[model samples]
Target: MKQVVQNYKSGELAVLDVPVPGCKPGGVLVRTAYSLISTGTELMKVSEAGMSMLGKARSRPDQVAKVMQSVATNGMSATYRKVINQLDSYTPLGYSLCGVVEQVGPGIDDVAVGDLVACAGNEHALHAELNWVPKNLYARVPDGLAPQHAAFGTVGSIALQGVRRGEPQLGEVALVIGLGLIGQLVVQLLVASGARVIGVDPDPARCELAERLGAEACGDPASAAVENSVAEITGGLGVDQVYLAAGGGSNQPVELAARLSRDRGRVVDIGKCRLDLPWNAYYEKELDVRFSRSYGPGRYDPEYELEGRDYPIGYVRWTERRNLACFLDLLARDNVDVEPLVSHVADFGDAVKTYQRLKDGELKAVAVLFRYPEAVEEGEAEAPSVAVPAVRRGTSVPAPARSGRAPVRLAFVGAGNYATSMLLPHLAQRDGVELSTVVTTTALSATNAQRKFGFARATTDLDAVLGDPSVDAVFVVTRHSSHAELTRKALLAGKTVFVEKPLALTEEELAGVLAAVEESGNDRLQVGFNRRFAPLLQEARKQFGARTGPASLRYLVNAGRLQHGSWYLQQSTEGTRFAGEGGHFVDTASWLLDADPTSVYAVATPGNEDLQVVLDYPDGSTATLSYVTSGPSGFPKETLDLVADGRALRLDDFVRASVYGRKRWVSSRLPKARDKGQSAELAAFVKAVRTGGPMPVPLESLVATTAATLAVRTSLVSGAPVTLARGR
Candidate 1:
């Protein structure tokens, strides 16, 4: 596909041919209609004072120091090459987009071919020409909502979430301190909620536009609420609430909000503005100071949205969608007018002009569109790929399909540290599976991985595996986020698939994947909830599966190391570690307990990230899990304690674990099999394809557990424990 790219080497924007992203399971490929350019964000992103090389070195002194440290430790030549490569890579533009779903992946049921949807996540936005939005982050566009309006959903959601957190009460005054795109939206929502709004901006026109949008008053405020001045508006009592929405400023709002608020008033700081108030002023004011996060609770939740699970479509009314709908409602009610508020409408071309206009401050109000009409170049459209027709299952076939091979030619998708550090070492010793390829993001890494793992060849192209008919199955060890899409693609290409934990980011992704599974009509799906493969846990299950009484298990763990995973920050990749790692224990508990979790209650301490979860099932059996992503110093990674009527089993580090209460209290230990799990998981994938036996971990059961995992994240975010789901 011909695509728009920014050349950092030449500093020019050009259209060039690139690969159109392929569709994956539990995801959809989109063709862009319109994408919104964020003025304040993108301008700051690549501007002179910011994003430039010198600016970066000053802004991130620690990173610069790290590079110097690396040079001192490794060598100057290596360090210079690393930094230079980063400088050569051009940064992509645009994050919010609206488009039509062109192809649907497996297990996805909610959205279908030709459906209009809003792209929400950052990575998904990059594939505008042909994007694969994991079911987790894509929100269905409202029927009447314009594509332009849909394009703003993601950033609008961020603003909406901040406004919601301000907790504005009707009849209360709300002081919005900033006047950027987000700040303006926050002002509009507070106004929509019937709060008397006071808009603050350094720019004259932004304040004027806020006035036109029903702000009772607007100005470049030295103070949030002046005692005498606000007395005239509020009869001497300060504002009921204050919202710090400005960017880059520090301490000014902290002092202003303290003086401007009435006793026991609410101060929700929602922007990048800093706070460095004196202790005396803060303590004397007695205000409820709060920080607003991106979107509302359940924003990144997987169970509620992906895997085809719903957030009741009731009490949880809009979720991500409702936020967009609210923004649309304000627009439709004429409460917030973007048309007049918008000072720029650049087309999808001439992207450079957008940067120029933003730096000049000629862009104001809502800086919606980026490329200019005149500067946008007219180019020949790239030839679209001829899509293969969707094949309906259970229908007549043209002839007999190709015969199955004896020993499957296997390809493993991801080769990051885990693949090298864990899975590859095991796959090297396995049978019934031949390693042919290891795909990475770049050809260089793929080559490095190929030699290190003894693969015949490595290529950045996934089509190399998909196009090779000899390839029978795929073992996916990529970051958690891409698991669903890659698995879906593999399945559609008539290959058996296995993936690591937390099937997809959200229930939506799971649902879409389930749809793909249904479409495949093939029972060769498996999830690597590796704890089950641990010799100790497997024995615990074997022991309890035979008993009739209730069983219990505990995954005593320290979570510090998890914080280092970059994928963890990207929810789709690592998931909330609660689900990514802890959910595996949840699934293990369900297995050892011989029952599915019927309900779960999670409680987290104040100023803590760890959550204590209780999973209850029928027959009075229960399991407890401590979701700790932060750990005590020098703590062991994982341990499990299990029990039934008269028997208790202890498992530690996949090496030494034994049962004590019954059956002679046998004591045994694993002789440190470092990579048994990778081998076992692959063997299961191949076995499921060959013999059709029960999988080590059933996809359906794994899907259910993932839903529960998502529930825990939602509960934590909402500060309310989520109830257990019975069926799905």
Candidate 2:
């Protein structure tokens, strides 16, 4: 139950008690035996995390650009909240580990429970007691290899990939320009390929270890005679290939590799060293230079790592997974010995101190391994999934467990920024509302949320929350990909459900959710379309109610563009903005017109921002939404203008409104804070739960809003208007 976590803001490391992760489909849960500490990569992360705000920005310019843009649009106050949320998060560490399978998820039959395997992948194979690893990121360890030795499989594959890039032939001579753990492994692998190897580093101990591990020769790069030594090792013809496997702030490794390589020789870089190359040094010799990607051919492909899709052996013989299997085979045959490379074996409980020593250079670790508690050979330890004991505020029992006028007991399946900042605060103070449980995938947040929000229990299991009799309704505020399934599950569990915007991403998922809602006879389902409830918008709607002519509304959203690698940009996880955040606008437009969108046409500039969508209604009214990212940052995020019967009302960020076409123009401003209608929305849901009344947002309206959003995406793809299917 203990996992290693680091605070990104302080770079503080600790071992914390956390709940075991649920087994997801296409993956297997494993109890860790030994996990290697990547000194080079992890130490850099620690140092960067400890940097000052300005320092951190200097280190990552792309992120700094995003922050500046956010400040431009949302003002300084709102953007600060977003930045703080990101910085204060607790992140897991380590990626190469050996473990025994504890549970197998659906579609994973290659390995079963109790099988010893080597696991890779940053999201999985973390330095924890238990991990959920995808099948492709795991390979069976050979019978006789020790857990400590097998844990080096991922690192060894990385070394193997660098050698493969060099294209070293049999009887060739290669120079490994770093005597670190990876450099030592590179030398041994080159020897296994029948090539004479030379290792170079500044540390004599590392050089000596490399020589002992099958390097024909070893030299310190700091030594003035190192270049001459390489020439002598290769019979005055220079090395046929050079593998630059050093990590430092200096560009010497790259310069040295280019100097020592023979004419037309290949130089493969696999380290975090400076990439500045001396063109003249290699151009004169006509040398070939290539940088080796981590592991091998399938490094960053989601289909290969997370989806269990393997490259055909005939087409790609040495994919990342295949390279893992090959390294284990070599270890089995005694071709590669990693025993001497391990400098320390620390207990998992003392991982924090071990990392401290490693970071401060107090411990010389070639490959430090964290040994876990003895794993059971039969069936692994049962993953912890029970609900945490309640922390009672008073002697009163929760409302769902009591009789008359009891408060509605609620459990939240996620604790994201929106739920924490917008929803929980209002619900916590509301009358007849009891916050029962809060669940998340990690521990620190769950514990933090429990203490901060006055929740009775914190857990990592959804089943525990769903099965609790004390819980009467569930809030689904997780990522978009999880909305449909989790909502369906809660409905089946006979609990009311309230999910955030964009009920479902696809038509099929929408249908499934609607079916589940029908099956829950008396229980209600509500999607968050909070804009319709905003006081300003509601007032505008009342004025439009008296008008008889067709209306035209224009919604402008200055949604800033996100940089690459942001979680929001990953459509599979977060869904497109149209299906995720745009639904709120669609619902607002439809609710104001009191008509279902009959057809939609859309177009967008590059990066899917600067979008223009037109929705046609059955009542002959039309709404135009211009979601532009290229707008100036000082502009309000959302601005709406509605025109009907020669009267026009303009709303600015839900904080101020102006009406035109009167004898004199009238304007009103909210007191403070833009009212996005979040409070009113939650109040409505609570009222319905207490009174057993109709769902706050009609199911048909939610469905129609989502259907229209999906139709916009379809229209953009086909470059034509997309008609909605009846009843969707």
RMSD of 1: 25.9
Question: What lDDT tens digits, residue by residue, belong to model 2 across residues 278-358?
Answer: 888888999888999999998899999989888998999999889999999999887887755666667788899999887
* Residue 376 shift from truth in candidate 2, angstroms: 8.6
lDDT of 1 by residue, 1-728 (tens): 54455544344444555778878777788777656766666555455233557766765567789999999988999998987786666556667777778898887888888777877665666523666777756777756554555667777777777777777888988877777777777777787788988777767656655665556677767643334446667777888888887766367777777877888888887776667866777688788888775555555567644553556666766566567556655554445545433444445555556565566666443555432121112210111111111223333212113335555566878888877887777677566556888888877878888888778768788987877877766778887778878878877676767777767766667766766666766545677776656555666556544767777766666676332224463332245556667667787777777666666666654212456887777777877887675577576666777777877777666666676654644436655663335566666666666654565666557766877776664444322345554432
Q: Where does candidate 2 stray beyond 4 Å?
A: 58-80, 376-728
How high is the CA lDDT of each candidate model?
0.65, 0.80
**Clash-forming residue pairs, model 2:** 72-633
Task: Highest lDDT: give the candidate number.
Answer: 2
lDDT, residue 374, model 1? 17
RMSD of each: 25.9, 24.8
